[model samples]
Target chain A: MTVQEFYEEVGGDYNEIMTRLRTEERIRKFAGMFTRDESYKALVQCINDGNAEDAFRAAHTMKGMCQNMAFTRLYQSSHEITEVLRGKDLESAKQMLDVVTTDYNLVIAGIEKLLA
Target chain B: METMEKDTILIADDAELNREMIKFIFEEQYNIIEAEDGEQAINAIMENSDKICLMFLDLLMPKKSGLDVLRFMNDADYIDYIPVIMITGEATDETDEKAYEYGASDIIYKPFAPNVVMRRAKNIMELFEHRIYLERKLEKRTRQLRESREKLERNNEFLINALSSVVEFRSLESGEHIQRVKYFTQLFLKYIMKMYPQYGITNEQAILIVNASALHDIGKIAIPDSILLKPGRLTAEEFEEMKKHTIYGCELLEKFKQEDNEFYHYCYDICRHHHERHDGNGYPDQLKGDEIPIWAQIVSVVDVYDALVSKRVYKDPFAVEEAARMIMEGECGIFSPEMIDCFKLAKQELFAVTEGKFSFADVMVK
Candidate 1:
């Protein structure tokens, strides 16, 4: 769908949202997040450290963000993972994480389509 | 009125009471569906590809266990991004680990508080959403990187094949001839560059020169086969016709010589005067001495040496030592005195190379 049509469907003022999101404050804040949150780069770190708990915690937080933004596919996939994590199950959590990896790609494709 | 837009959760278990109680608790807040077994759970997940946001699955059920359901989802790739909360009467680390391996999202032991269950579900859902966002960001970056890499590989292949094909059509020989020439040219260039560091050619420059050498006979493609493949000596007219390759080769290369292109001049020079004599008796316009392009001259010596030693349709292969002696003699006075001396010094090694007694890799050693 056209970006404008998508915005209309979402009941949003497309141009206004774009302007607000592109403002210096938001871009700076977004860029600053790389350093501000150690958890933001958690995927690479989790794999490196072999700490499933940390990975699970990071995934839990990211899943929450996906839900809030209505990224249903990502939210659902990652949610299954944190559920496995809370149960103190590492192997299944890793498996669920794999699912997240696949669906996460699809979510990215959708986002790119929207941006275009 | 519009639908309330509530989250949909599936509760799958063999026990009707367990399903009913969970449904009753969540029905007000979430749209609920029920499945009685692993088979039913898999079916439910498949049916609700994206609509279902959460699942409460019982550990032991008829037909298939909860772990079985998880494995099915993981294997078939049927599960959506929804969170799964596995319900069990006896939750052990072994069972939990196995379930998780199958992609169970969460585990809740039976006879637990509804509030705790609800809270865990809410937390998991929140976390699920955020994880999706960062993942999407990373995926977008990865896809962009993949596309650019593919494009680069394609362009590299296109240019290499285009350049080599020009050499291929020049004679009756297969493309393998170019491959061998390119390989040996690189080996010799690498050896000399290392042994004589004062020459100041970088590895990259050597590689480009080797690539350029692939087009050494590109102009011969325009020559008539009667002249090119003629086994016997050529008449003066045929010889004169053959000499025009240098001019044709240069003119062919000139068409691509844009001002900003770094390699154009190198290519143009090599194509035009590779056949020029050091004493000024060779080619379309032989200026002689140090006037010949060094790259062309370098190629000329190697090309003639290889051509002499290799078996052709018309002539038997010359002995490597004989070929080396002929190159050293410089019958046409086409090569410089210094190059002839270099050929003499390197003759044994070149002989070994042509006789298949030395490897291309061995030749590359400084």
Candidate 2:
């Protein structure tokens, strides 16, 4: 997938962020940090460790990263899991982690393809 | 030097992308400090408390959360010092409420709008800067007011002492007489303060008493030179005339009294009642015991002591030992037992004054 295809698939306002930043260089720098993020991996680790608070922090951070990158599908999934963990409903949040992971993986694959 | 320095902004987030985006927006206008996690954010805030003017805190991080940082700021009283804007992925009522409760100045959703973030940060920084400016201005004004009040008090003291010297010169008493009386009054008052905490006689009151001692003989100014300057013993009529000096002094100071001028009250009491005996056998109204103001009692003992030890037209100067003996024996006038005791304790200092060694002006300097 090209950068255009990735933006189309994620349904993010790429052109808007670019215009707001006033330069493609800034957009590329933002995208570089986005590609290197480890919030999803940390979220999965916290879920496996059964640390509800840590899991909440991890999911919340992942959700924030997704929003900044304008990865709508992944942001929505992460937000759901973050809310569930915030409520201290660990079991429910654990059940939703798979959906979050799938969306996050898809975003990562699209970014990798675009960057390549 | 300070004007040459740049304002610092802190960006605290677990996501490098979030930090970079915010930094890119503010780097041109401010000096940026980045903290990768909540713990680092708190440490940065602690170390650079005076330098950092604004913060962009992420709601979630590894060691501590943005809410935790806010709580720390609240506990440490940094909430008002540094304005914080929480960066979050999604906006929820729950997170918003918690952030505000913890003292977050404002919250911004992620996907960081470059313009909105810059505008919000600038506005909050200016607001706090203005607040700090007003606070410093108020402090400086308060200091100025206090200094002027102190200066007025010092000038008032100088005028009172100048007037007292005029009365002394007119009465044919040595200028040193007023100095001796003032020193003896301070010595006695200091003992009273140390021994009697219940009286609540503050240092300020003691200074007023000493100042008023200068005017204790101001009524002598009103007497005729034929009577006041007489070197011989006075007739019964002439003695009665001399006794009226206390009444004259009180009336002279009466016109100067204002509601808040406590010094006038001290002067009035010392002038009218210093000649009164503690045994109720003394002149004027013949006020007895505590009926006479404490200031009057203090000045009364010092006046008689100075009179006995200083050479006058009517008599030769007595030794300090003889003066103390006469006062204790009630030769000059009956005094309070407590006053007599403090007088005895101050015998050495009083002797120094009579010998022209220690001066009351020294105490005034202190």
Which is the leading candidate under DockQ? 2
Q: Tell me the whole-model lDDT of each prediction, alpha carbons only.
A: 0.66, 0.83
lDDT of 2 by residue, B171-245 (tens): 666687777778789889998888767667899999888889989988988999999888888999999999999
Candidate 1 C-alpha error for residue B336, in Å: 3.0
lDDT for each residue of candidate 2 in A45-109, tens digit (9 for 90 to 100) = 88888888888887887777777766777778888998899888888988898888778777767
Q: Evaluate residue B267 in candidate 1 and report its C-alpha lDDT on the 0 to 100 scale.
A: 67
- At residue B38, candidate 1 shows an lDDT of 83
- Tens-digit lDDT string for candidate 1 (B1-366): 222333789999765545654665578888888997789888888888566878998775657878788877778775436678887655579988987877777888654555667889889877776676667788889999999987975676457657767656556565555555666566556555756576677876776677677676678877888998787778999988888887788878877767766466656666777677788887667668878866667777777777888888668888877777677776534587656755666676667666667666433222
Q: How big is the positional error of residue A28 in model 2, measured in Å on the Cα after superposition?
A: 4.0
Which number leads on TM-score? 2
Q: Which candidate has the highest lDDT of all?
A: 2
